[model samples]
Target chain A: MNTQTIPPLAPDAPVVLEMTNISKSFGAVTALVDVSIRLRQGEVLALVGDNGAGKSTLIKILSGFHQPDTGTIVSQGKEVRFASPRDARAHGIETVYQDLALIGDLSVFHNMFLGREYHKRVLGLNLLDNRKMREQAQLYLDTLGISIPSVNSTVDLLSGGQRQCIAVARSIYSSPKILVLDEPLAALGVRESAHVLGLIQNLRQQRQVSVILIVHNYNQIFEVCDRINFLHSGEIALDASTADTSEEELIRIVKSGLGRKAIDAAAAQVRPGPA
Target chain B: MPPTAIQPTKKNAVGVKVPRTMREQLLILLSRYREASIAVVAIVLVIYFQLGSDGGFLSPSFMSVVLRDTGRLGLIATAEVMLMITGEIDLSLSAIFSIAPYIMALLSVTYGVPLAVGAVIGVLIGILVGAINGIVTVRFKVPSLITTVGTLFFLQGIVVSIYNSQPIVAPVEQPFNAIFGQSLYQPTDALLSWHGVTAFTPFLWALLVVLVLALVLNRTTFGLHTIATGSNIIGAREIGVRTDRMKIYNFMIAGGCAAFAGIINTAQFTSADPQAGSPFLTLQAIAAAVIGGTSLLGGSGTVIGALIGAFVVASLNNGLVMIGAQATVSDIYLGAAIIAAMILSIQVDRLRTRRRV
Candidate 1:
């Protein structure tokens, strides 16, 4: 109920995604209440909240894993209902979960192609076009500035950062209009985190895709995100441009569950930088 | 480091760099195909057994018998490999193998059904039982090992009760028997004297099956998805893979193979024994797959490796018998071989990891 608005960073940019007044419940448990968020074209918007703050519920709705009890989701001005994850994918909304969803036993190209494999018809059988997949996977990686030893290398042998990069690359290769990344840096080390952060930054600079990043680390959010949406107790508490907010202010707002007036009062006292 | 360790890379005519040394090349090959080590072990075993048996192990007639055993066991092992690669196991496959032939024999002899139709029904029953196992495992969330074991006992009980714990002797006519299991070419001194090899139909069928399944596993999207389903079910699902359906399809494939193997056995012997479906047979099939380099943990395996493994197992049994060793001694060797293969596979994995690092 205490949703604070910040001036849009790119006012002229089209809103690629809009979720308004979305509410969801599981049996007796109300997971989300009147949550709404908007993603502008080519903007990286970070959704930051503590545990049990309905960040996952909002994400699940966006990814088509769960349908909202109430509210509408509009993509490019047309309202859409996602009955399943496949439907969401069909609409070009790709989500890379915390696990990265890459099969370890498969080669890089195979993982890149996983469910949506390229196939060539052979004697009425749709056989895998492995050569095409390998070439395309390598080309996609190169275009994304991701460096790996080979597309033929099994994914399990790759480093954590490399695996995350592959998962991101796979989503991007699908040419999703909106990319959702859930805790991509949570399991990675500092150097690996930097690698992923750099990739996100590169994506923002080089691609037309909009990103909704769900992260806990405020420093990472500030480093790569153009805006931040803070969720508190199944509600959006703060919506502000990353340039207009400091990490300390975001932390205070999240820790205190501040009302809109208090958040604005707090925001006025702090400079928008590292503490 | 030794000077030999620092070999220079060579460029082929295509201008691509190639591994400079045989050691490096071998390592590269081994890493790319985990089954290569098992293939080597099988070859070494064949040679060792041939020498130990004074070349009797390699005699055409004895080799035919060994290959026949390989054919039957390889079919089941191939089934296990398919299911295993999808992170499932069908303990009831041997039971399906046992009952399918019985169904065929009963239908053909007692009910006067056509032999070909009976055989098809027998395989269909196997596939049906597999579907049941798959449905129970996926829909009910029962572990496949448990679900299939339940089916195994249930099917075994049905076989016992129906057959009264007796063997049915069904006289299969010519051509049908020949197509299924009878020897295609029996090399004798008078005919094809120079060839010196016997070709059993079952062995040929096994070869064909292995070749086809190998292609399916390596070249098809279904195969890749199966591997992905086994490797990481959660991950596979997240990526829109029908993980449960894949597991079910693999279970069905395992069932079909088991039933086909059983039908082959019936054709070869002209009889179906109710008590033939045993857990020991199931364990042996699993062992063959494991020895052939199929991972018990799943996500990685090859049908060809399993077939070779079947040959290795059959050779051990036949070679031991040829050398006049006790039947129990082959069991001891088999147990040791399984352990050795697992250790070697682990070491090879570690080597790959170390090299990658």
Candidate 2:
């Protein structure tokens, strides 16, 4: 249920990546069908949908966890397909997963540098260069007007919001051109959700960065994102700018069955989440 | 409380907090104090035995045997503790230990090589065995319990199979045999008469292992990784630790140490018996680790504690044997002790975690 819908996006927001005619199926289930959306650099595009709306499937395909059966993914005007998340990473695309997928026992620095560790050796390999990793981890956090005082404290000690922030920091640390977030604020309290939305807003300030956030929180979508796309039953039913749309339209699009009556009924009864 | 106060308590959510009685708390604490309590028990037994005899248990001769016998076991225990910390069990270490000296014997006696060169090669062979075990465990991602158990059987089979494959046993030379089997000094009457045993270099070897392993576990990054990996794989992975590398390396280290132990055993005897290292597999290594305070469940433990645990187990064996107890009886008691140690550690860890809240 959405009470306040977003308006249309401004013309200045440049599209950085686009997936056209995307279709995906698992055996015979057909989880996604003919879905497409464009993401713009220095702009936030919030993917709004209900449960079983094929949001997960769509993002998984983009993140390289799943491959779309038929689609042309054009990134910065060049078509591409990723065989794995690691492959996507090489092309400057990163995802901050919902679970945070961080090493809970590892220090903040180690978690950020997970997999993509920096090392110095006698001739470019060998030695772990732990001192340099720690110094650089501090520098990365400092750039965001945040500081993890100790690079040594395990990630488990941080609160839920801080952990999400840390995951975002880690994704941005590699300076990826496209960032995808999956339901980041779902489990967070009101204050934590606000902080995360603020961080997203700050991220939008970076000119070369583009973000696609998959969230059920439409209020959060309106607060932070410039445009919105709605997925229903494996298809994009509504694609509109936040500046021009209303939550009633989004709810109607969501609850509208195969008839006019359901759409009218849904439009009449739209009530957003909490106070 | 004010609305904005941090802990906004809900009346329905609060449960009755019952404080445990003094007797219950004492029982809990006693259970928590594992190796130390066991050590105390060992001390009590020693005191009792000493008082029962013409104070022989209190005599330097008896204490020396305890220390020297406990030393070999202590080395194996340290190695076992290190592996346990990394959440992998190298049940084959016992077999590796027994097979090592045989390798040395073959090199020294069959090839007619110098003892020093044979010994160095033997050490390398031991390291190789450990590394291979590490590789296999990491590659397959199999439960180490099953993998190492298989290796234990395999290594033991190999030890027996190739024990005399080269048909070799080095002749016991003066200093070579003395370093392994004899004490540096003994209280003896004038004539250099026979009928005496002394503390061996194997004892010193055990002590050195304890000191070195304790420092490595407490101070090194490798040690930290071992703890991290065992704590939670996801937690360790999120931070980007190659837990796989840590475990395999740990298994290798354990294997290498066991091989070195085998060499010590063979040098001490100055002869390689195909089946000599057999009993050592579980009885000594596991007992030592348990006594040293290493948790088989992994994550937490200390090397010094394991050393102490080793001594306790060794002393238990020596004491029971002295009192004419059978080998089977010793095994039963050893099993009981290890089980008790494990249970106590678990309960204590839970208590501490709960107290943190």
- The most accurate candidate by DockQ is 1
Interface DockQ per candidate = 0.39, 0.17
- lDDT (10s digit) by residue, model 1, range A1-275: 22223333455788889999999999998888899898888888999888888888898899887899999999988999998788899999999987778999999999999878899998998899999999999888887767666788788877777788888888877878898999988777676677777777666666767889999888888777888887777887777878877777788777765655665566556443221
- Against the native chain B, each candidate's TM-score is 0.89, 0.82
Predicted complex 2: DockQ: 0.17
lDDT of 2 by residue, A157-237 (tens): 555666776787788787778888889887666765666666676666644567899987666777777777777678766
lDDT of candidates 1 onward, in order? 0.83, 0.68
Show the colliding residue pairs in model 1. none
DockQ of 1: 0.39
The residue-level lDDT of candidate 1 at A74 comes to 99
What TM value does the first chain of each candidate achieve? 0.86, 0.83
